[model samples]
Target: MASDYYITADNVFEYSRGNSLFDGLNEDQIKTLFSISREITLGKGSYLMHEGDPAREIFLIIEGELEISRYNAKHNQNHVIATLKAGDTVGEVALLDRGSRSASACAVSFCRLRSVSFDDLQDIADKDKSIYSIFYHMSRNIGERLRHSNDVALQAMEKQLDEFKTRVTLGNFFVYIVIMLSLFTFSLDGLKYIMTAGKNSSYITLPLTLAFFVFFIFFIKTSNFPLSTFGLTLANWKKAVREGIVFTIPFAAVIVAVKWVLISSVPHYMGRPLIEGLTAMNADPKTWWMFLVIYILVIAPLQELLSRGGLQGPLEEFLSSKYKVPLAILVSNLLFSTLHLFMSLEIGLLVFIPGVYFGWLYSRTHNLLGVWIAHALVGTVGLSIVGF
Candidate 1:
């Protein structure tokens, strides 16, 4: 087997430029170019450049494929911006403008690349007009390719969006079928069971909740999701927490006002009495302290571990290969919602919407912090009324 290694200057010079923008370079110029360059190898699944990071150097791919992606917030996915094969150069635009990189670059295989710092290349361009021409032409060509790639990506996104609409329609149709069949099979019995279950649910809730937490922890331990995928370390966690609190203050104020208004003005829309029962449970000092301990030490961390850490990580890897954002979101969201079935169908659906949103956020940002914060916030607010 060929030893996969990093890009180096010697191999970079030997590599044929073919019809690339750099193809105009003669052998002598290519050799001269090698003088200022150094080779570096990247293992499969390694990053070359991250979006929004300073573009300090230009990369010439000597082997394997390089994937370029831009984060799409609306879709909550990483959109493929372009792909580069051997002899392709990346970050030329960033080099010219001294701007942050617009896309992230990752090595798809064990690959080699030749890198030249922007400062060094600028010096060469200043002294050698020919080199400057090469740089200008390469930059322009790359820009044109990027624009074309963007157009193609947009078309693909539109197509995918249409497909997503179709899938959602199909999914809803299936759900209706299931609901109808269930109603036909056990109408009165099912209604009675639901009513009885709701009345007696408190006895089972604690055990079910504990089971869910345990399973969540196990899922996290067994999964391969990278904890720091979004550059979220302990330091980032603290920062995110601070930001989360800031965001929640305004959001909570609005929610509280809306809830108060609805409760006071609308008889039919009166809020559920569930919160009152929870509030009473929480008002007991001993119960409140225990609830706090369970949540802070157990529930919050475990759920984050399972949902964001475990589920989202493997889900990203699996979906990345297929490149089907909607399907990935649906599957992951379904799983998230299914785990909450013991709660209530209404609660499950409520959690599902955010589950899909969080999955998308994870795919786009490649970070777990946002979803973790959202999950924790939901639990804290919803559970706080009960006492935790």
Candidate 2:
């Protein structure tokens, strides 16, 4: 297309009458604008503006079509924003902010446009009394474009978020199945413990259980789960202490109640793990202190880290896929309760309350330190009450 595709002065009156920025200007003002504005032509497939170029001019499309597009590194491409036509205004934002161009525009067909540089606009605003009113008009157009751009960006963001959720759901599903398999194995082993009554299997199975816990963490990590996923973090230690103390108060009450009921109601012929485990404490005072220390430190952290942190966190996430928060909590609660199956159904049922409560605390806090401390304190208190 030739440079004179549109004559600058020929349509000055017509453009000023209807064009947004120049509208409402008198004939003298229109003539003055026409004197300074340039007429430019772009051949098909030629760029009119580029992103990051210095903002200098605004354009009034006189004839033919152009397309607006933006580059996104994430998609590794330019996404088309709009297809503009004649009488449509472009580049008004340049006249206002005079910053870098946000998007690129290219002519789709041979095009003619009236262009007014910022310097020309500034000169007109300085000389003419009426030119000051164009700012609001330019701002309104920029706001519209911003809103449109935001809508496009928002749609893209929503799509990305949905994809991320799908990935997380698939991950949780795999982790959930593995944990269930591990629990099933543990339940079977508990039966073996009950049958043999710890006579010959102490050295082999106990060490194996410890090894299983280590492998369980490795297994979870291999699935891309972090320890922090189970709310295990030393970050926000003060908040953890407060939550631990708060959780422990009710926890202590529940522990005392459970222990009281167990002692008063259950008979003493028990050869269950807790009883048998605590019986070893009676060997001597040194052994008793050592057992208490180990219980408070090693056993308590490991158990809560397993059931509440590791098991409950992923299990709840798994159940929450198709269920509500209540059902998710309930399912995890049941799974935690089953850990005591070797003791009795009654004991399993009894522990379920604390399991649910502890899981709830972990969910609310998202830090295991609180629940770990509460679990340790409650376990120690409960064992002491049982004279273990």
Best by TM-score, which number?
2
Q: Where is model 1 more than 4 Å wrong at Cα?
A: 1-19, 73-77, 167-388
Candidate 2, which segments miss by more than 4 Å at Cα?
A: 1-169, 172-176, 179-183, 186-191, 194-212, 223-227, 261-283, 315-327
Model 1 lDDT on a 0 to 1 scale = 0.62
Pairs clashing in candidate 2?
Answer: 231-368
Q: Model 2 Cα displacement at 71 (Å)?
A: 24
Candidate 2 is scored at a TM of 0.52
Q: Which ten residues in a row are the worst by lDDT in model 1?
A: 222-231
For candidate 2, lDDT tens digit of each residue in 1-388? 4334444466668656767766677877778877887878899999999988888888878888989998988979988988888877788766676778888999999888888888878887988768877777778777887898899889989978866765675575566557655866766765566546644222332443465467457646554455676666776767877988886887687655555566666776244343334453344566666666766676667767766666666665545365545565677678667655655686577668767777777777667787778776766665543442
Clashes of each: 9, 1
Please give the lDDT score at residue 163 for candidate 1: 64
RMSD values, in order shown: 17.9, 12.9
Residue-level lDDT of model 1, residues 1-388, one tens digit each, is: 1355543455544564564555667666666677788877888889998889988898877777889998888988886768888878888888777899989999888777888898887787687667776666787787689689879978998978866754554454345335433543444454347546554333343444455455444433443333463224454555555555565555545445555666677785466453453463435766666765676556655555555554555444445466665675676578667655655686677668656655655555444565566556655554465211
TM-scores for all predictions: 0.42, 0.52
Q: List the residue pairs that clash in candidate 1.
A: 6-40, 6-41, 7-39, 7-40, 7-112, 7-113, 8-39, 278-386, 282-387
